[model samples]
Target: MTITPETLIAAAQSSKAWPFQEAQRLAKRMPKGKPGGVLFETGYGPSGLPHIGTFQEVLRTTLVRRAYEALTGGAPTRLVAFSDDMDGLRKVPDNVPNRDMLAQHLGKPLSRIPDPFEKFESFAAHNNAMLRDFLDRFGFEYEFVSSSECYNGGKFDTALKGVLSNFQAILDIMLPTLGEERRQTYSPVMPVSPTTGAVLQVPIEVVDAEAGLIRFTDEDGAIVEQSALGGMAKCQWKVDWAMRWVALGVDYEMYGKDLTDSGIQSGKIARVLGGHKPEGLIYELFLDGEGEKISKSKGNGLSIEDWLQYGSEESLGYYIFANPRSAKQLHGGVIPKAVDDYWQFRAALPGQELDKQLGNPVWHLLRANESHAGANAPGSGDTLPVPFSLLLNLVGVLGVGATREAVWSYLGNYVTNADPAAHPALDALVDKALAYNRDFVAPTLAKRAPSGGEVGALQALDAALADADPAISAEDLQTIVYEIGKQPEFGFDNLRNWFKALYETLLGSEQGPRMGSFIALYGIAPTRALIAEALAKA
Candidate 1:
């Protein structure tokens, strides 16, 4: 049940989730006495808003790192996120507030786009910073590298020379993949302008160990020249992939299935460049509920920020960790429900077996719960009874403004039936819900206005309640309310329908929590006064 690196590697090999044959070949090339460490790198192209797919990639990489750590008996691993911000923007993303400005920046480096949030200097920095925050929220540790910085730092010089030496090999591979015209458009490392057909050139020079500079001629016999610092490797996309793999010393990386062909070419290019072949894993694509690829350009994607607002951290973790590694589409909305179910399943299974089943990532989540549970603050307890949609529905039906705490109380008391007395863990869960509401939940509960007839019915009920003697016990009050509701003209069904109408008028929703129970808990006096006020306004 305790997943170790060996077990994970075996599982991956059995599942064919990664290139096991290539992994083995690479393993043999590893230096002795130096245990081969896992390195997971996710590439982000900063052309638009970061979406759920980007989160998916990082989450998976974190899971892999955790799994590898467990396997290697706590050996160190590297998780790096590379931002391709140096690349020119190919097209302006839709829904960008400053489309006109962004379009003007098109064909320019992403590092040049003015930051929309005005917090960072450029759009790429803003997006990268957001990505870092998102990863931090998930408890991932990563070293972030920007393409602009890497290139400017001259980190790719050696790799660039290797690429230039293997330029013929690259053309031999790429020429077959691309038509003759496309092949001609490529240089040894860089690409010519597609439209202008001009050979784009870079300045190059050599430097010594003490940082002394020397200008150099092109390895391909071109007349191009530049300073030593400018000698850094800058290549077309595929060659860039090959050089980066060698330069960064990456050992393992996973890509989306859509990029499988490109990954294969990169692998070949790496071999041609005489670098160690990095292990590659391919994960399935994510799809929205409607079965389409989530795309930012099409305005058909969800962002991590949006998901976190409506979902639990555990839910997000489960979405990235529990799913199969094969290519397939995932439903975004089902993620939270799935996480809740996973917790239930873990709770139901025996300890040792459950530990075995959920693996290291889930165990880590449970540990996070244990570490933070006791420190939770008082008055911070409350969570939704069911899903957010359900809570929104209940708020609609109650005809009363409800706080997150109110909804949490209802959910714990009714829907999930989580007994705070029997299950003390439910308190921490409730606290987490309260935190979520405060930090992330959107105010979508107030969507409708009460109608005249609905207000009148509520006013009548309130007047009756106010006239009746106020009872000390909640049970006594509930009995009186039921008695008033049982009248032939104002029966329970009619009263319930009236309440539902009020909800629809106020919230634009038909269904919600039980009416009588909701009123009893929230208090009849406030409920009555709210109704009367609505009637007065009408």
Candidate 2:
């Protein structure tokens, strides 16, 4: 499909990808001809190390920027991953090394606290370096901004003045959300103590809008006068959000759904600060399997390192692309399916309509780099005929930590023409599958005990294999399994259950690639022997 300008424009206009619609809304809401292209912001909190959930937002924001550029005749777009490091260290992250040290720094800004690992200038710097390292590794296009720098560098001096001038109005906007006690003392600006260098949450004794200064009681109850400018003081979160939007002239920004109310308040405060709010995109947060929000404190869901260990960077990108507005489970268990779906999209990309291709998440996943994180690297051979889940199980057939060449040799048993060396992309899957098996599958296999029905089903399958053609293809073998499940005694409701039966008793996993594909690759005789052995104990 040759994607023409007209077709691209129409597709961009109707694109269901959140970024495309966001670009259109931003283009209308924020007129062009500004000093820079459309500016977008992805907020980060440095209280904890970055994770997969945080990484997805940056990648997703980049997609929007790309879409915006295409829609506006290559309009410029800048994605700023702004970290709110100036916010106080409310609590120590459960994962970091130095808990006792961090406990001593509570109420101190993240940028001011000591690095737990003693590597960077501060805890925030360490986290920031970690974020940049992986982002650069993935070749993501973004600029990093620290809230501490913006505050102390006097970069937001003008924004500070504007907020202070409208202090009463912002107070009126915020007071309704606070308790009566907080309503009386809470100010838009959160004063930083010059004496102890902590963010003072105490009552403000004075505010001088003309001078951009606030005097408040410090943590020890001593008077501390601080300038709101030059990073001596930072505005409270919602107010700080509004100030940044105006200071940077952010055209677009996205937030988690939990921030909906705070976002609206930021918009109101933006108006009070004599500026308009950025066009906003609210995404549902990634959740653990238990349907609870994934956070550093909770220690649930896969970390960015964990996800990348068992899957490709593009696989995680595709996971982010799938129904982003809807909350999704981001656990180790979801990795293989994401990898398989990426292949499905790539396999289907060819012969697809231009608009249809545009709508596919695989399309975006492929172009992980500039001009693309294309699912198939240029000249990289096609995806393996087998799915990733299936590949993992087949790789597992070779036992733990089997080298790629060994797995390729195993594939040669059933496929006379099998050559993984020709397919770098598919071969990489073999490596990841080995990692997935060693880490996620091997341990679970120790406790897999088939139920009575599943045992009978396996026994039945073994008996059917006894009479099956020794030279049957994977596709034909798949049909035999389907027929076995359809028999009255098995009474399997669907192929899904039938497949699950095989996975539980055979692979010792909840999901596996199609049995036919495995059968075709494993060869008829070896597969039957494996099944017979598994059913022996039944």
For candidate 1, write residues 262-346 as lDDT tens digits.
8888889988988755765677776666778766556564566655555566666666665435543444445445546545544
Candidate 2 local lDDT, 204-275, one digit each (tens): 634687788777777777777767778788889899999999999888888788999999999999988888
Q: Model 2 — TM-score against the truth? A: 0.87
Per-model CA lDDT versus the true structure: 0.57, 0.78
The ten-residue window of minimal lDDT in model 2 covers 373-382
TM-score of each: 0.63, 0.87
Which ranges of candidate 2 are over 4 A from the true structure?
Answer: 31-33, 97-104, 205-208, 218-226, 371-382, 400-405, 414-420, 443-472, 479-513, 534-538
